[model samples]
Target: MADVFRSLNLLETLKESIEHNKLSDVKDAVEDLLISRINLAVIGDRGDEKATFINSLRGLSAGDDGAAPSQSPVAPEEMASYPDPKHSDFRLWDLPPAPSTSPFEPEGYMDRVKFARYNAVFMTFSQPPQPNTVEVFLEARSQQRQTVYFILFAAAKGTEKTLEETRKASLEVLTSQGVALPKVYLVRPSTLEKFDFPGLLEDMGRELPEIRAHALLLALPTLTSTLITQKKEAFQALVWAAASLSGGVSAIPVPFVASMVDCSVALRIISKAQLSLCLDDESVERLARQRGMEPTGLKALRTCALSVEVTKGEVKKRLAAAEKDLGTVSPKLVEMAMPRHARSASRSFTAMLQALGGAIEEMAADGGKIVAAALGEGK
Candidate 1:
């Protein structure tokens, strides 16, 4: 109910801005939504595993351009930053390992790493909880950073019993060290589909701030159906913002001019959504390579025109098709939630909403199919 109210409030606000000719304000809001950043800090020993995990999170392999180095050269006291090649605003900072001293000093370490700047912290380890690790978690808690995670990598390849024992022992150690109810995720860095990695992303989506969570979801590769659905939801919100912006711009006196402007806005929005959902050519090829398949085969699975490329001709065709189905393509939930006055005020909003909403649905479907094909699920 609260979410519904928030959406309604946002719609009302946008409507008011459009009516009052505050298009600049609407434009700024849309821009901010599209370009939000998420800084994730990975605090672990610098090694191939840690570097591989960081690259995997960014949908890359070690040898991919802009991937984190397989062996970091930064000293133990410094931090190494790797930006997501697709989304520069989403960064991963590989911090130095926790101090190994018996008496753990968290303040100096935290300050040196600029811990507060990170939206989330992932502490990766293969062994039981060490004192320095516990101290870092405790300090993060004290600093009111609630999005910290304990990731146990390279521990999931063992038998189920061994994995359970590792988890139990880690939890017990953390409890003994006064860290209450610590969240630990056991993941195989090489294969996120194997274990707790999906759960970790779900937790982060719930815990991080709304904008950051959206950014994280869009920035990540479409690995699971759940992630594809989540990406759809995020892009739905983005489409709403973009539609509102289109409506605002349609306030221009010349109808043809307003239509042209809306088409450009729609093209930009759809292109960004394509990249976010990993429907672009490069992302598809990378995912194909990760799955050891030919890129052309994976690319063939995407049936939507906009899913593979966002050419001007494709956008026009999609828009024309959406126009014919406007009555059905306009999201029914959005229409029900919106007040009648707002709906009646702008035909352009409905048009853009239908066009972009349909494009997003098709692209999301394509993303799911690509993942399914890459994972060899339907075979």
Candidate 2:
């Protein structure tokens, strides 16, 4: 149909614009995909285990600001909510214990808590799923809610066999209900360095929509190599956008100036890329502190200053220097230099992108090393 053809053409045009690094077009496209809110609920008995797991998911250690409050013996009516420490839009709720009093119909409780409103609900327990937990999951599934089971191994830190037994028993509980087995993550909160935390994150990403998944990935600390690579690729697209914008500016002509394009465009792109990729100083420092290390030793972090902001003073100084060099040349000489100057500007822009790419690579590598060291991987 003609309508279909037109739609295809429009999409192709939009893709081309994004590829060419049109800032407004790219910004709009990215925004269009981010339409859903990422809200999750961690429901279980009144204990610190649920709070600890929530903190780990948000990349917060105990006592961190904005972290899920760690408390014991929570009241049945209590609900503790906390915005993600990194991305405030993504919120996590710590729901109180399922009410044990009489006249508590599972359906009524579900409706009262508005359980279906969240993107996902994590049913956490240290032991096998209790009757109340099973009732909650069944009611949640009936309402078409996404659910994941988290079995904490803090009490049993002995053999690998214990983990396997716990997992099998947990799966059997779901199987007994004739419902499909939902995702289950086995965690040891006391020692996050061990267990299946990384795989849990990967599974969550796989299950979530692309936009929410990317946001979750960005919010997570660089705990695995795959995460670092995904973050880097996300930033690489923005880097190309910056380079494309610079290329466009190179085509313009000016009387005295070498390049007519605004350097701030490229600078803004760099700043955004650095922050989104978690390569900014504050983000890196936080991750480093989480790993119990100083942030200064990494050479990749040293280039962070250049990516923050490119000031007008620096741009003016460079322009003045370029014009001063041209002042001595004749008018004909200046005319001849214009094309070369444009080419030079393009090359400089390319070089900036290259430097940024190199820095990202270094940051990813350093982050991986830090994670490996902290986890005692390959030791």
Q: For model 2, which pairs clash?
A: none
lDDT measured at residue 90 in model 1 versus the true structure, 0 to 100: 91
* Structural similarity to truth (TM-score) of each candidate: 0.90, 0.68
Q: Write the per-residue lDDT of candidate 1 for residues 1-379, one digit (tens) a residue.
A: 2242353235556656666667667776666667788999998877878988998888998778988887787776789999988887799999988989876689988888899999999998877868898898998898888999999886535887888788888888988999877777988887887689999998987888867887788888787887888788777777777776665556545356456556787787788889888988899989888889999988887888889889888877766776566566435544543344445534666667777877898999999988888777878
The Cα error of candidate 2 at residue 3, in Å, is: 31
Candidate 1 yields a Cα-based lDDT of 0.78
Residue-pair clashes per candidate: 0, 0
lDDT of 2 by residue, 77-141 (tens): 76777787546567888886576666557887777677867776777776667666677777766
Task: Return the lDDT, model 1, position 71.
Answer: 72
For each candidate, the alpha-carbon lDDT, in order, equals 0.78, 0.56
Q: Which stretches of candidate 2 lie over 4 Å from their true place?
A: 1-26, 32-37, 72-75, 100-104, 147-158, 190-193, 238-359, 376-379
Model 2, CA-based lDDT:
0.56
